[model samples]
Target: MRNNLHSRKINFVQDFLRIQNEAVIRRFEDMLRQEQLKLAEADLSYPMSLEELNTVIDQAEKDDRNGRLTNADDLKKEIDNWE
Candidate 1:
């Protein structure tokens, strides 16, 4: 048997996808479809609306300045609590 790099790569990806549970693959496909739709409708030349994004950035900066942030321990604890 001879090995081809492109074929090997394709087989690896196919195996990876096959190993994923059906429900996970379906959900991933749905997310990919949604992202494709978003890209299709996106306007590259459109100016960004700063009002909402600026507010979010300002809030994040304020939190950082005030030391209102989580440490690794806090993040681990939060993840542990997740359902």
Candidate 2:
């Protein structure tokens, strides 16, 4: 019974270390990607402020609730008619 408990503790420690290593690797990969993007001169635009995003979302929800938004198929049909 004591041996079994010791084995379980070892297994738990191994699992913990594995997860920690994986997290560190993921962070390293992310840093590398960011560095590559910087080297490539990618335009890293800042996202809209929370208030601005909230306003956009609110407007979209309102339009959806009021049936002001067109369905994809319907919009396509309308465009076809125009053509």
Among the numbered candidates, top TM-score falls to 2
What CA root-mean-square deviation does each model show from the true structure?
15.1, 20.3
lDDT of each: 0.83, 0.85
The model with the greatest lDDT is: 2
Model 2 ranges with Cα > 4 A deviation: 1-46
Residue 57 of model 2 has an lDDT of: 99
State the lDDT of candidate 2 residue by residue for 11-66, as single tens digits. 96776567757777788679889999896665446667899889999999999999
Clashes of 1: 0
TM per prediction:
0.33, 0.44
